[model samples]
Target: MREPVRLEISVAGHAGHVFASREGDGGSVPASGPAVVLIHGIGVSHRYLRRLHRLLAGSVDTYSIDLPGFGATPRPANTLSIAAHARYILSAMEQLGVPEFVLVGHSMGTQFATEAALQAPPGRISNLVLMGPVVDPKRGTVAQQALALGRDCLLHESPSSNALVFTDYLRCGPVWYLKNLRLMMEYPMEQKITGVRAPVLVVRGANDPVADADWSRRLAGLAGRGQLQQVQGTGHVVQHNRALEVRDGILAFAGLGAAAGGEPLPGNPT
Candidate 1:
């Protein structure tokens, strides 16, 4: 596997980080095959998405980004809106010379992805993969989301997953987490998804209490070209425990097939 190159970039005065890896020889991927960009959820960094990035990097260039204020990146001077976060991502992509790519987002990352898609030029994004998207309108309040997340973690998450998540939360700190959590809750995901030009795939863990099956399906249906998939026996952080499944789903949606060879990526279930 290719080792990812870490990057520190400035976008509109805010700094962000990216871990970039590529398929095969590190040559530029053709326009026909768009590179993949991964956006992680709030209060967490690229650590949760590292497995998925490694898997996808075998067939396509992959970028896992740490939006400003999360991960190792410092918080901006002021709280940024969802649109501002999207702009920051777009700026980073521009700096990387990625004219077009697939945007894959998880949880609150989905909101950022959607906003980015809306802001990008018509054909910049080929596909949008939203895994365990958040803030279901019916249960849009912070209390409801907290209750759902707590329930899911207690019932479905593994010990390692909990450890990683909470540790990242500690690094992110309560103030930052709550600030962004409010932004996540206030954003209207269902309505914003309708504006996305790319085909949409909404993925969920079967036991993800935060983004339940019904909400996932609804979010997908709202998009112009949307679909949904559920990974069995996982919770909200599906990409961590079920990385292979999530990777295959993304490849299939992006029309990349199983992998370079016509076989499932190693470590993936046959």
Candidate 2:
């Protein structure tokens, strides 16, 4: 049901693709309101995000991306850091002519989202959504994180979800995966998020082993303006299986519902 990204964009030589609202894409370019941009975790691409992107795009302009070195995008000559990746994302969105947008990230993508929100110019990023955030400080080592991911795949994720993930992993290959694994393990998500000015929404599946409940709550409490939501009967890929739930949380956080299009929730200050 997902279509190929019709455009390829680059920033500082790092190229990536974006699937967004455009003519012939079933949705027109968003004229107003904050756009939604989805970022995927390592070893995966926009394929897994397609469902959520579709759900969000129906109400507001939305985008799902394939970052450089993953999916169809060509790999970079060298591995880039979290900040460099964030820079690529922001620069590419600017090229898309997006003035302000909401950033939604899953798993390791949370790291990139946090950095992007922090790095964006004041008022550019309206909200930050981190679903199934990763690298719990107490269990931050590769072995522990791998164990949690394996447990999640075996116990929580569905067969179709497993298929999408493993296929993306195969495309990512072990070399590029291992090259960035260190950064994912070392990046302090909790610490980095503390500096983000945008309101943060931390979401995790109640059953997700990768992102412990306590950790998600902690990250929310650390942010200047943050909140946590857990979707029941789901896991690490919460947004995929519980797309509607994710959509509700995002729309509520953005104050889109209960108040017609592009307005703050009644009585709640934006």
Candidate 3:
């Protein structure tokens, strides 16, 4: 039998209340261990990470928050940039009394996570795990850039149209969603990814349509503690179809698997 998940809602800054949840309300966190801060990619909400969270429950104290404009939370009054997103999550963590954590970012969230880890107080971010991370905008092919631009324009310029196109994101509404989209586009990720100090696990689906193998390799090379892993037969949403693979990699990297407390990461665990 599975434990019934519990909800813990808290208002964050002027952004609105974040509906965070977990299984146990007890004193002890969990066996998987350290508090984890999960960040989702563009267009999706915390719902996208549901499977990854469940798979990791036994080993980590997991927390997933809807980015300012995404999920169920309202957007903030100020512009939402990579820095702003990072700051907000940090503040949320501070309020929760979570001193340190492992960051798990998917797609666009990976870009924000990189910026966040760079700014995190020393010792605050223990590790970073990026799934389908974004490539340098300039490095993206013309077609890729065009797609990214089209997506951004839709989210920022046409709220009604965007809502219709990305009904999932629109659930959060346009005002904040548009603002958040603008901020994500303006972030200078290329320069920042290199400054991150935490160990980074750059993961991707073998068949990911967006962040392809080449893109993942390049981003991995640019991160703080970068390494690459390709989940076979999976697409951009590797966490969705290959939850076990993703969780296993994270456990090994975070040193949660049986072995030395913090052993070096081994190649493909399959």
Candidate 4:
């Protein structure tokens, strides 16, 4: 696989980093398809999404962004709202000359994706994918979310997944994570989903305590064009471990059947 090109971009006075990679003999994606952009959850960075980025890169152009305050990007003077983060992403994409593409977000990133879809110009975003979307209003409190996260890490997540997440959390530091966690919990995801114009694919790990089945299904149903798929034996960080399955689901949802191939859906183990 070819190494992703690192880019430093500034949007609205906030600097961010993006790692872009393409498939094919010379790292070129076919012009026929829209590019795929991946956004990671809160307190983490593109590292968690890298597995999925690589998997999808074989068939489409892929870019994973490190939003300001996470990863190597420096935190801005003010805490940004979900909508602000979306604007930063849109601005960065605009600067990069990405006129149209598929936008995929996981956990808190889903909130950012939803806002971006609403704000993007007509036809600028072809599809939106939300993986393990956040703040199931039923468990919307910070304490509840923390408990769910702990439960997910203890019972559902793999050791490697735990390492990646906790390490990123350390990098993010407690103060930043808590600030963003509050923002994530306050966002009205269900209400916002109804406003998105693009088709939406809501995906989750079968055992993801963070984004349970009922919430995921309800989220998908809220969209004008929406569908849900579950990856078995995975947790909140599904894309990191079950990347192939997630990639196939994304391709199939985007109507790229040849790229998706005939991979059978993973069954939920009893």
Candidate 5:
């Protein structure tokens, strides 16, 4: 039987009364396994990482949160830059009293994870796993790219779109979205990629049209200690369609053994 989803409330910086949810072996990082926190793409929430959580739950503690405005959380008034989102996640980690852990981010959340790792003093973040990272905005025109980033980061599109992922910034409304888009456009992700001290694993779907395999390789090449992993027969949501593979890759990256059902990453190491 499928487990019922559980919701929880927590306070976040500037954004009061933020919402976060979990569906795993309660919040306990294994003594040997590293803690893993899953951050979703621009339009989804912890739900995006649910399948991945289930695969790894048996070996390591996993937590997934709705960014400020997206899930059950209300939008915040603070400037919602990539840095701010990282800080919010960090604040949540502080509340949980987790001193160090691995960060697994999808799509836009990859930028937030990278920013978080850069901000923290060396070694605070053990490793970073980025799935379908958006290093370059492929929306044709510059303005189109800006608009897409803004919409993805701020505006609530349809109910079908996961509002929780972009909720906090949405709470700030259109102006906030525009500001965030401008910031996202200006932030030099490639410039900062090499400075990340933690080892990183960039995974992408073999068929991911948005973040194609070539882009994934480039992303892996940017980190100080980085490598690429591919999920076969999957798209951008690697966790959902290829949960077992994703789980095993993360485990191998963390020095944990192979997850029960799949082989670990099998490419030439970077």
Candidate 6:
């Protein structure tokens, strides 16, 4: 597949970039359907999501964004809150002229994505996907999260995924990452999910140590219209390792085809 076209987006006074592509669209076609906007966690950039982005683009328009202060985007003068990030994200999507789209966020990106869904106008954000969401309240702290992530990286993640993460972290640098670490750890993801009006899909990897099964299920239950789907044999970066499965679940969530099999949540709609 060809590399996605980078679109430099100016949102207010802030600048960010998004890699836009779709099957045969050649970066020229206007997004026609509910597009998929992939948002990465802190430190990492759109590179990790490229494979999954292409896979999803085969059936729907896809845009993987590099948030301000991450990826190629320059660091902001000050650390922005999740709400601020969400606002910029919405503005960028509007600038792109995406009529309606799904918000897919990994790790702490879930915090930003959930905030965006809450801030967006009804119908503008068609759906929300939280993949390996983070800062589980039970273990919400720098040390706790770091230990879990370290264990996950050392024991479970594939070699390629770890390499991608290491390079991205290097690009992010420790100072910029630490600056925002406290905010991510403090964000109440569970409470935020309850405010999202759009359908929420909480996806977790069966082997993920960070967003464990219990936390994922609770997050699903918290949403007004939430569902949980765990991709087997994959870890935190499930989208990269099991792109097809994640695509199926997302497409199904977006009402494009048959329902994807997911872990049952007693209160959440299938």
Instruction: Choose the strongest candidate by TM-score.
Output: 6
Across 108-172, the per-residue lDDT of candidate 6 in tens digits comes to 89989999999999999999999999879888878888888998898888999999989999999
**TM-score of candidate 1 relative to the true fold:** 0.92
Per-model TM values vs. the true structure: 0.92, 0.92, 0.77, 0.92, 0.75, 0.96
Please report, as a residue range, the 10-residue window in candidate 2 with the lowest summed lDDT: 259-268
Off by over 4 Å in 5: 1-12, 15-25, 28-33, 137-183, 259-270
- Model 4 — TM-score against the truth? 0.92
Question: Which tens-of-lDDT digit does each residue in 58-144 have in candidate 2?
Answer: 677788878999898999999999899899889988988888888999998999999999899998999999999988988978899
What is the alpha-carbon lDDT of model 6 when measured against the actual structure? Answer: 0.88
Residue-level lDDT of model 5, residues 1-270, one tens digit each, is 134234343544454222222234333322434577788655446665766776665666566767776555666656577887888777777676667778988877788898988888776788888887775634434566545445433332233233433453354456645655566557666667778888888887776655666666766776767778887766666667678888888888877678333223333233
**For residue 16, what is the lDDT in candidate 4?**
86
Model 6 spans > 4 angstroms off: 264-270
- Candidate 2: which stretches are off by over 4 Å? 1-5, 22-28, 258-270
Tell me model 2's lDDT, rounded to 2 decimals. 0.84
Stretches off by above 4 angstroms in model 1 are: 24-32, 259-270
lDDT of 4: 0.86
* Pairs that collide, model 2: none
Clashing pairs in 6: none
In candidate 2 the C-alpha lDDT for residue 113 amounts to: 90
lDDT of 1 by residue, 166-227 (tens): 99999999988988888898898977887888888888999999999888888887888887
